[model samples]
Target: MEQESASGLSGRAGNAEPVAQTPTPDGAQIHEDYLARARRGSIWQMLAIALSLAIAAFSIYVLGRAVSAVSLSALRQAIAATSAEQIASAALLTVWSFLALTGYDGLALRQLNARVRYKTTALASFTSYAISFTLGFPLITAGTVRYWIYSQAGLTASKVASLTVIAGVTFWFGMAFVLGAGLAFHASAISAINHFYPLINALIGVSVLGAILAYLVWVTIRHRHISIKGFQLELPGLGLSLGQIALGVIDQCAAAGVLYVLLPSHAELDFFTFAATYVFACILGVLSNAPGGIGVFEAAMLKAVPVASEEALLASLVLFRVIYYLVPFLFALAFLGAHEGFHRWTSLREAMRGSEEEKVLEDEINPLRRWYRDNWRLRR
Candidate 1:
């Protein structure tokens, strides 16, 4: 009967012959566009996964060959020979690198106009990178962690996604800047790895820098925004863009310094030259999608950075992994666990308090209800 009445009322209101609802022309076109985009995205994702697997497999092969010649006793002695001062320097650089990492998320939030607290942004950035660096598949691990924290701070999925994209751009910008400058200034040194003419390497560096200059000029002239699948993302202005690059450079340099300081005193490579090699290895490691770029980075570093004592270099790499990657990863896990527990306890307490207040209100209302009922009976 209710359904019939509702149908009759709707029909009377229309006062015309009923017509079946169909999607509008624009709506249908939009749906088709979305489907096409999804199909393309899936294809790209598959290709990326296949590429990562290939890189990882090749890296593992390279690593196996490299380590076969290494002597365990020599490696142990090399590690023991590392001075307390070198360890202290590397540890300090690691701390500095992570501090710069926190700026990535903080700057990203500013770009999004999302007014989250610095501590909150720091927590998200540090924890996400720490977990993702050790776990592999940053888009999954880092994005998940960022979303988990940012969601509670009033950021939507789209906003968090945009923030992640912006932060990634910051990192790449810094990398390109570092690589460009290093290659331009010391192309001869880099030629040892690439076997290219110094002039050619310098040209490549100049080209990269030129591209960055072009982008800066373009943004300065007008506001730039990207529209991907109907979502609009505003680009940071020239000043903020510069800041992003600076922060990236600082972070990458600090990270590279950690490994550089740990290397044996006999290695004797310049900081700028070593930084270029470090960035290159790090990039390949990232592409391989292996946890902490395990085999890939070590393999690349071994191949690029020529040292007399491979065992000593390997020892330094091991210490770098422990201080820069493993320690932070463990710390982040414990911190995340504690944060989750505290949040749950706080929520439970709030819920109990709300329930208690409701119960108290009900207790006070019961007496008034009885009084009103008795008065009503007398009046009747």
Candidate 2:
């Protein structure tokens, strides 16, 4: 009977299945595959970052060379010839113009339903303009920086991008209006330049058409039936579009005036003629991709103003830079400093709040109490 019982137990043990183990090789293979994918992704990301840095470095080097080649003596001569009163007036006007530029950002933000404070918006606008002027690449210029700042204001990336695009359109539309109106009314000026360089008009026309086509494509893509975060299409209507166009005219007129004021007193160029030349020169400068359009702007201005002597034209360009670029640059720097300081204070305040919360928890726990101490020790 005992032998039969023992036999039955051994049979039961034998019938029970073995516990399954995960295959080490399969686990290792999956880990290796994940590691390989990560390595490949990292390599590509590094390569892209390296390439971008290299391109930026090369561009800066080239711009530096161009700036060094400019005649400082001529620039100084121009500066000396400019009247102090005129310089002050030009400076004031330049500041006012830049303030108007802040409206571009305001309008864009309003469209995006991101109503930032006036001070914050002004800082963003000025800093962006300053960076764009200094960097010369609009993509890398102020827009990226503005996006960062605006993002901190609780805006999503897509909203910031849309605002950026709108602001860009505002700027370009103003430029185009200035260019078009200048060409239309100052046909004589256009005729003179076109007679000399027929290709200029063609190039301008092509650029304008290309911009329009690009905008249409962008709008079409955006207006397609798609939703992001429960939000449908959020584009400005025809009324806002017209308002943008009008703003552009106003902005460009002010910008062109900066150059016009710097010209020699005897220069036989009316506002329309000046605007035509200014727009062409500015377009050429932007195309050159030179920092602040430094050498490019000077050269183009020299070419456009045939009535003025080369020296006089060079002088005018220098004065224009001082009024429109340098002074604004200083103000932008001040604004950036203040902005950073405010952010630092806000961060400190957040840290203090976190510390206060920690203190409150400490007070509630009352670590000095025997039970609390015993509980804390148990937890540890």
Which candidate should be chosen as best, given TM-score against the real structure? Answer: 1
Q: Candidate 1's error at 159, in angstroms?
A: 0.8
Flag clash pairs in model 1: none
Alpha-carbon error at 67 in model 2, in Å? 12
Write one digit per residue (lDDT tens) for candidate 1, span 1-380: 99999999998988977688986679889999999999999999999999989888888887788789888888899999999999999989988998998999988898888899888888899999999889988888999999999998899999999999899899899898888888888899999887989999899889988898998999899999999779899999999999999999999999999999898853557889889888889888988878879999998888888788889889999999999999999999998898899889999999999999987787587988767777999999
TM-score of 2: 0.68
Worst 10 residues of 1 by lDDT: 261-270
Candidate 2 Cα outliers beyond 4 Å, as residue runs: 1-75, 196-234, 364-380
lDDT of 2 by residue, 1-380 (tens): 89999999999999999999886678889999999999999999888667645544554565465455557786577668888777776777677778778888888888777878887788788888877886678766677878867877887877776777778878887777677666545555676765745455546645664665465566555443335556564656555666777777777777788777777764566787677677776765665556776665665555556653455666776678867887777877887787789899999999999999987788677857756777889999
C-alpha local distance difference test of each model: 0.90, 0.72
Query: Superposing every Cα of model 1 onto the true structure, what RMSD results?
Result: 13.2
